[model samples]
Target chain A: MLDYKLLDALVAVIETGGFERAGSELGLSQSAVSQRIKLLEARLGQPVLVRSPVLQATPAGQRLLNHAQQVQLLERSLSRTIPALNADRTRLRIALNADSLATWWADAIGEFCREEGLLLDLVIEDQDIGLRRMRDGDVAACLCSSDTPVAGARCVRLGQMTYRALARPDYLRQHFPEGLTPAAFRDAPAIVFGPHDQLQHRFLAQQGYHGRFPFHLCPSSEGFVRLALAGMGYGMIPDHQSLGEVKAGRLADLAPGEGIAVDLYWHYWRHGGDFMERLTTTLTRKAQGCLTV
Target chain B: MLDYKLLDALVAVIETGGFERAGSELGLSQSAVSQRIKLLEARLGQPVLVRSPVLQATPAGQRLLNHAQQVQLLERSLSRTIPALNADRTRLRIALNADSLATWWADAIGEFCREEGLLLDLVIEDQDIGLRRMRDGDVAACLCSSDTPVAGARCVRLGQMTYRALARPDYLRQHFPEGLTPAAFRDAPAIVFGPHDQLQHRFLAQQGYHGRFPFHLCPSSEGFVRLALAGMGYGMIPDHQSLGEVKAGRLADLAPGEGIAVDLYWHYWRHGGDFMERLTTTLTRKAQGCLTV
Candidate 1:
C-alpha cells in the first residue's frame, strides 16, 4: 500500500533534512517533495514528522521509515541469495554503542565478516537507541542494553560489561583522602561519556550521592579512561580497558569490590541467512570470553 | 502544577531506563515508580513517553524533561549570580559532535573555559540530536546542523565542513578509472560514518547513482579517513583530515572538483549572561580563522 516515490521522498527528508534539500537530493522540486510527504501522511492517516525546530520522525513516521528500510533490506538480501536476479554483495548492518566498539564487538565480528564475505555497516549510537534502530529496521541487528527483544526480533544475553569507578591514585589521594563522600564528589570532577551514558549516574546513585556533582564530559569511551588516568577526573571505565591500569597502580578503583554491571543483549531480526545465525553464535561466544564470567 | 517527586521519578526512569531499575535507582519500590509516572501522566492530561521496544521521549515528553532540566540549570546559574547562595564551581554543559571535539572545538574552547572560570561538560552526540538535547534543556548550548534556531535559541553559522570523495590511488585505479560512474560505485566499497550521516548520500545522489552499494562501517570521523587510507574502502573524508593525504599523493579525490559541504551552526539558549556571549564571540572568530576564508 506504500508508494515507493512517496516513501523515497520521506526518507530523503529524514536523511538530508528539510523539504528544499530533500527535493534537491531527489531531483524534484521542493513543492513536489512537500506534496509527496503530505500524500504519504494522508495515506497513513497520521502526521509523519514534527517540523518546527527541526525535521524528525514522529512515532508513526518512525514506523513507516522502518517499513521502508525493511523492504530495502529484503530486496538487498534477495539479490544476494539469487545472484542471477542481481549481483550486489551482502552487507550486514548492525547497530552498537561506543563501549562495545572500543572493547569487543569489532574484533570478534571482524573475522565473521571476512569468513562469510559479508560487509558490515556498524550503526554506532547509544545501545538502547541502537536496538530501537533494529526494531525500526534501520539495521538488521544490534548489540544493546535490553535483555528483552523487540516484537519480532530475537535476543541473546551476552555477559555483563563491567564498569568500575576508577580514578588516578593521585586524584584519589587529593580529592577523596577521606574516601568518596558527597563533599568529595562535589569537589572532584567525574568524566562522563556523554549526556546519555548512565554509568557514572548509576555509580553515584548506588553510592547514595545525588545532587548536582561536577563532571567532565569526555565523549569517547577509551578517551574517558585516558582522562581519568591523566587525573582530569574520576570515571566509570570498562574493565576491559581499566583492569590492567588498576593492576599497574596507574588507576585505583574508587569503589573497592564494587562495579557497575550492565547486562548486554544481542538482538537480531527473525529472517536472515545462515550467515546471521553463525554471527549470533560467534558473537555470543566471543562476548562470554571477553566479558565478566 | 507538576509534582517535583513525580518529575524526579520520571528523570530516574529516563536515566536508568526500565521501571524496576528506575525504582531501584530512586530507592522506591517498582509499584511506587509506576504510580508516580501514571500520576504525572494523569496530571499532564497527555501521554509523555512513547513506551515500547525502546524508552524514548515523545515530543511532549521532551518538552517536560526540558522544563525540568532548565529549572536545574536556572538553579545552578543562580548560585553563580549570587556567590552567597552556594559556592560550587559553575559547570556549563554544551552539546557537540565528535568531529568538532576531535578537530578544533576543544582547543578553541579550552581558553574560554579557563578565562571564564567555567567548568565545561561537553555532551558529544549527533549534531541534530544534540540540538534536541539543547531544546530539552539538557545543555546550555549546542553545535548542530540547523540554520534555524530551536524555539528560544539563537543560531550562528560557523562554517562548512568540506567532505571530498576520497580513496587511495590504487582504489581509484581499480574502481573508478572511468571517473565516478554508476558502475564504478557498484563495485567499490565505501566507508560511511554511521546510518544517519548523509555526507556520502549527498555525494552519490549528485553523481546520480542510486543503487545499493557495498560499504564498510567506520564510526569514527578521523578513523573513517584512516580506514579509507588503509584501503578498507573509499569514503567521503573531511577536507581538514583529507587534504594532507591528497597533497602527498597518499589519497586521491575521485570526484576531482566535486565535494559535499555541511554548514555547521552554533545554537544556544536565548537568555544568557556575559560568559555565553563571550563564548559566542570567541567561537565565531576562531571558526572563521580556521575554516574556509
Candidate 2:
C-alpha cells in the first residue's frame, strides 16, 4: 500500500510543479519532498517522477496523482462534514453552472440548506464543465446541462434551460434593419465569457455561418450578462438569467424563434449520504418550479 | 474527504460483523483492529461501529462503508493494473450475472482478453446484483438485465437473453397431459436457484398465476440448470443454456410461446481505464453473435 503522507507530498509537488516550491507550500524541507518521491518510487518498484528542473509526473505518477486527488477531496469532505454532523446538522458540496448559480439555483440551495441546518460549499463553473468536476470527486453533487448522467453518478432531469440570443434594443435595431442574417453576424462585434465559450459561436455555426468577431471576453458570467445588458454586443443568455434585464427593457431578445433549449440535470454520487440525498431531493423539487421546460 | 484506511477498516469490520472476526479475516490482530477503529472514530469525531461483541455500523458508518468499499475496489484495480500497463497492455474488470457466466459470457471475456492482451478480473453475481457491484466500484464494467445504467456508469444494450420455460420431457409430459395451465402449476414442484431467484416466480406472476411450490433451491446457476436437466422440477432456462439438452431430447420447452426476453446491458465505469473500453467493445461484438432476441 502507498503511504498517505508520501502520496500527499507527491501531489503537492506535482501541483506546485517543483519540489522546492511544493516544500515551501507544504511547510516541508525541499529534501523531504525529494525523499518522499524516492520512497514512493521504491515502494512501487518504478520511477514515478522525472527530475528535470521542473517536476514532471511519469505515467505511474499520474495514476497515483489521480487517485491521491480523489482520496484527498474525499478526506476533506469527510473532515468538514462528518466531524460537524449531528442529527440536526449537514454539510454539502455542490457544483453549478454560473448562470444557475446567479439565478434561482443558489436561492434554492440556500433555502434548503438553511431549513435543513446544512453547510453549503458552492462551486460555480459552466454547466458542461461542472459535471466533470462532480465525476472527479471534487463536489458531492452538481447542477448541469446534460440529461445523460456521467457513469457512476445518479442523474435526474431538473428540466430545461432556454437560451435566447439577446442584445441591447438599440444594438439590435441598428444591426437588424434588414433582419439578422448570416452575412451581418460575420462582421458583428460579440461579447463572450471566455475563449473556451462556444455558445454564440455554436449558434452561428449551426446556421452555416462560421465567423470571427472582435470579442470582449468577460471572464465572469454575471459580468458578461451585465455587459450584454449595457449594449456592448449580442450574446446568448439563459432566459432565467436574462429575465430581469429583458423585462426591465435593458436588453431585448435578438431572435425570439432561434433559441436553444438545454435540458438540465441534477447529478450526484449515488452513495446515499444524508447531505447528498437531501440536496438531490431539494433540487428536484425546486426545479419543478424554476425550469421553463 | 474521509480517510481511506478508516473507510476500508470500517467496511471490513461491517462485513465480518465484529472486530475480532474482521481482524482475523484481514490478517490483523484484534487489538490492531480496535485501535484502527478508535482512530477512525476519532478522526470522524463519531462512532462508526456499535460494539457489543458483534459489530454493527451506524447509519453514518454505513454511508462511509459503501464509499470505502467502492474506493478500495478502485484502488485495488489501480494497484494491479497501473504497474503492468503500457501503451500495448490493457486491464479489465467486469461484473457479470451468474446465468451469463454459466452460459457464453466467460468465453467472450476470455477471448477478448486473449486477443487484446488484457488482464481481466471477473466479479460474478446475479443480474440484479451485478449492477450494484458495478456501481460500488467492485468492477470496471458489468453485464446486467437493467436497461437503465447505474448512476455514473455508461450503459449500452448487449442484446436480449431469451428464456423458455423448460423441464425434462418426461416430467413435462406427465404434468401437462391437458396442456400446461395455471391451475396445474399451483401444485407442481419447481426448481429455483434460491430465495433471491425470481425468474420462475416472474414467469408465473406474468401469467397471473399466484402459486406456491415445493422448491428445489439450487444456489449455483450451473447447479440449478443441471437440476432442471435431471428432472428435479420445471424451471425457466435461457434458450442458449438449454439448447444442447433440448437437441439431445433430455429437456423440452414447457411453454414455447410463453418465453421471457431479458434485455442485457453492458455498463462500465465512466472514468474507466483503457481495459474497460477494450473489454466493452469486445464483449459487445461477441454478445451480438451469442444473445438471441
Candidate 3:
C-alpha cells in the first residue's frame, strides 16, 4: 500500500510548484521529499511528476491534485463541523443573491431551520460573484445564475428568474405618451445596483441603444426597489421581487414584452457539512415555487 | 474538536445494536463503549442514545449515524481511490441501469473511457435496486429513478422518460378494435420486468381499471422489450428503447395518449472516486439527448 504521507508530500510539491519549496514548507528534508515521490511512483507503478527546471504536473499528477484538494477541503470541513455535530450547536451558512435574499430565500431558509432546529448564517451577494465565494470555501452553498458549475463544485438548476424593465408609474407618465423609444432611453436617468450590474444596460443594448444613464446606484435590491417605488428612475427588477410593486401600480412595466430571463442554479462544493445539503434542498424547493421553470 | 474515534465507536454500536456486541466487533471492552458514548454525549451537550434495556438512537444520534456511515464509506473509498489517483492503472468502475446499458449508456461510457485512456468495469442492474449497492460501498455511482437522493449521496435529474404502452401489432389487432378500452385491459396479458414493477399497474389504475394481468416475467429490460416484440404480451417501453421496433412495425402503440412518464435521477455517494463525477457528467449529457424532458 502507498503511504498517505507520500501522497500528501506529492500534493504539497505539486501545489507549491517545486520539491525544495514543498520540503521547506512541510519542514521535511529535501531528500525525504524525493524519497516520498520515488516511493509513491513505485507503489503506483508509474511516474506522476514531470521533473524539469520549471515543475509541471502530468495528467496523472493533475488527477491526484484534484482529489488532494477535495480531500483537504473535506478535512477542513470535517474539523469545523464534527465538533458541532457532537454539540447542540448547528449553524448553516448559505450565499445567495441580494434579490433572492430579499424576495423569498430568507423565508425558505428560516422555515426550514425552524422546523429542523438549526441556526443559519446567510451571506448575501450578487449572484454572479457569490458562486466564486462558494468555490473558495467562504460559504457552504449558494444560489447563483450559472449552469456551468465551478471545478470541484456541484450544481442544479433551481429555476428561471425573469427580469422586466420597470419605473414608477409617475415617471413613466412624465417621460412618454407614445411610450419611450430607443432614442429617448439615452437621456433618461436609471437606477442601477452597481457597476457590474448590466441587466438594464443589456436590455437597452438589445434595443439598439448605446447610451449612458445618469446614474442612481443603489447597491441593495430592497433599496433599488424602494428607489423605483419613490419614482426615482427606470431599472430592471425580477418579476417576483417587483410583482407587488407592479401590482400596486407603484412601479410600472417599461417594456413588458422585452424581458430578460436568466435561469438560477444552486451551486455547492461536492463534499461539505449537512448544512450545505439542507440549504440546497430548501432553496431548490422554494425556487420551484417562485420561478417560472 | 470531536475525536474521530467517537464517531467510529457510535457507528459500531449502532451497527451492532449493543455495547458488548460493538465492543467485541471493534476489539474493545464493553466499558470502553459505555465510556465513549458518555464522552460523546458530554461533548455534544446532548444525549445521542436512549437506553433503558434496549439501545435506541435519538434524533441527534440518528443524524450522526447517517454522517458516521458516510465517513466509514468515504474512509474505505479514500483508501482504494487515493493511491490509484496517480497510478498508471487505467481502470474505472461504472454503475448504470440495464435499460440504458442496452440502449446508449454503455456506448457513452465506453467512448469516454477510450478517449480518456481508461479501462472500464461496467455494473448493470435495475435502476431502483442498484443505488442501494452504491450506498453499501459496492459501486461508485448509479443511474436510478429517485429524485430525493439517498442520505450522503448526490443526485441530478437527467430528464423525464416517456414510456408508451407497446404491443405486437398482431396481438393488438387480435385483442381489440375499441383500442385499449378499460374492459379489454382487464383480462389482457402483460409483460412485466419482474416483481415490484408497477409501470403497467399504475397506468391501468389511472384509467379506473383494477385488474390483474397474466404476467410474463422478463427481468432484464432488453428481455422485456424482446418478449413484447416476440408477441408474448403488451408492455410499456421507453420511446428510445422501443424506437427501432416501433419504426420497424414490430411493435405498435396501445394507448399513446395515456403513456407513463418516469423522471430518471442519477445518484452517487458523495465520496466515490473520480469515476462517479465523470460518469455523472457523461450520463446526464447522454440522457438529455435521449429522453423527452
Candidate 4:
C-alpha cells in the first residue's frame, strides 16, 4: 500500500508551490518535508518532483497526485455517509472554464453546495484547455468543451454554449461600416479571450477572412464583454452572457445568423462516489435550464 | 550580431507555442522553422527550447525573447515616428491582474489605444505574481501589486485598490451572527480569488483568527463577486468592483472599518521607448482619478 503520509506531503508541496509553505501548512519542519519527499522517491524508485526553476510534478508525480486525489474523494464520501466520522465541511477542487463560472456555474451549484455543506476550490482555465488540469491530476473534476474523457475518468455532455460574434453598434459603425467583408477585416481589430482561445480565429475563418488581423486579448470573461461594450473590438460572446446587453441594444451581432455552438462536458473520476454523482445531476439539470441543449 | 530572421523564428515559436503553428503563422514549413531554431541555438551554443511535454523556452531562450521583444518595441517606435517606414499597427503584450482589468484598466487605456492605433495582448495573472511574466519575457509590461521592478525594468506606483470582506445579508446573518469572532470565522466559509490571493488570509489574521478556515477559491474577479452575491461565501472585494452591488443592497461589508489596501504598480522595460513612456503617463494620470492614491 502507498503511504498516505508521504503522499500528503507531496500534495501539500505541489499545492503550496514550495517546501517551506508546505511545511507551514502541514505543521512539519522544512527539512522534514524534504526528507519525506526523498523517502517517497526512494520507495517509488523514481523522482516525483522537479525542483529547479520551479517546483513541478514529473510524469510520475502527476500519476501519484491523481491517485491521491481519488483517495481523498473516496474518504470524503465515507465521511459524508457517516457524519459522525467528521464534522468538517467537504471541499472539492475543480477546474472550470471562466465563461461558465461567470455565467451559470455559480447558480447551478449554489443550492447544491449549501445543502451539502460543501466548499469549492475552483481553478479557472480556458474551456479548450481545462482538461489538462484533469490529466495533470490538479483537479477532481473539470468543465470543458472537450467531450473525450481522460484515462480512468468519465465524461457526460452537459449542454452547449452558443457564441456569436458581437460588438457595440458604434464599433460596427466605426470599423465594419460595410459589414464584415474580408477587406474590412484586414484593418478592423478583433477581441480574443487569450492565446489558447481560438474562437475569434475560427469565427473569422468561418466568415471567409483567413488573413492576419489585429486583436486585443482580454482574458476575463466579464472583461471581454466590457471591452466589447466599450467599443474596443468585436468578439465571440455567449448568448447566455450577452442577453442583457443585446436587449439593451448595447451590443449587436456582427454576423447575425451565424454562431458557434461549443458543447460542454463534465469530466470526473469514474469512482468519485455519491457526492460527485449528486453534484453532476444537479449541474446537468440546472445547466440545461439556462444553456442550449 | 544575431540574425533578425533567426530571432523572428524563436519569437514566433514561443508566441504561437509550437513549430507547427509557428510555421503556419510565419508562412514557412515546419522543418524550416525547426532548422531556424537549430541555427539560432547553434549560434548561441545552447538549447533554446525544451520540447518534451510542452514547448517552452529555456533560460537562455527567455533572455533572447526579451531582447527580441525590446527590438520589436523599438522598431514600432521608429515606425510610429516615421509612418512611411511601416503602415502596420503596434501591439503591446501586457500581463494584468483580473481585478484591475475588470474595474478600471480598459477605461484607462481605451482612449490611449484608439489615439495611438495600438492593440493589446493581455495575459491575466494574479497581481502578486504578474511580475514573473516580465521576468519570463512573455510580456512587454505588467500591472501588479509589487512595487519592485525586475532586472532591466522600471516600476511606477499607479494607485491602490481597497478591498473589504463583503457578503450577502443572509450569509452574514447565517454565518457571522456574532459579528467576526474568531470562533464564528472557524466555520464561516470565505471566498478567495485564487491560491496566490492572500487578502482573505490577511483579513482573517487581522481579525485574530489563525486556524485553518474553509474557503471557496473562485478565480474570476466577476465570478468571485457573483459567488459572494449568491450567498455562497464572504470574500474580500474591491470597492471599485462592489460599488454597484453595495448600492443595490445585494452585498454588505462584514467589517466596514477594516479593509486591506493593495497598491498597484506599472512595470515596463526601462528602455521600452516612447510608446511605453506615453502609456505609463496615461495610466498613472487616469488611475489616480479612480484609485486611492
**Which number leads on lDDT?**
4
* Model with the higher DockQ, candidate 1 or 4: 4
Q: Show model 4 residue runs off by greater than 4 Å.
A: A8-66, A127-129, B10-38, B41-63
lDDT of 1 at B69: 57
Residue B263 in model 1: lDDT:
80
For each candidate, what's the DockQ?
Answer: 0.24, 0.01, 0.01, 0.50
Q: Candidate 3: misplaced stretches above 4 Å?
A: A1-85, A273-275, B1-293
> Per-residue lDDT tens digits of candidate 1, residues B164-206?
8898898788778888788888767788776566777788889
Tens digit of lDDT per residue, candidate 4, span A1-293? 98989998997787656787789778999899999999999999999999754577788897787677677667778986787777446667788888998888888888888787788878887654567777777678999998888998889999999999998898899888887887788778788876557788789789887665667878889889878876778899999889999999999998887999999999997788877888888988988887888
lDDT string, candidate 3, B1-293, tens digits: 55878876886675455677678657889899889999999999999888742466676886676555445445444645676544332323345654564454533443454344343334555665566566555455567677777788898988877788898898798666677676677555676654446687687777676543344444456546655665656888888778888899989988767788887777777665455566578867866666766
Each candidate's fnat, listed in order, reads 0.25, 0.00, 0.00, 0.53
Estimate, for each residue in A1-293, the C-alpha lDDT of model 3 and write its tens digit: 43668877886675444677568657897789999988888877888888642465565665555455445445545645675534332333456666765555534444554444343335556665576566555556677787888887889998887888898777787665557675467445576665456587688777776543344544556546655665556788889778777888878888878999987888877675555566677877876777777
Error of 1 at B37 (Å): 8.9
Scoring the B chain of model 3 against the true B chain gives a TM-score of 0.66
RMSD of 4: 3.1
Model 2 ranges with Cα > 4 A deviation: A1-293, B1-34, B45-95, B111-142, B194-198, B201-218, B273-275
Q: Identify the candidate with maximal DockQ.
A: 4
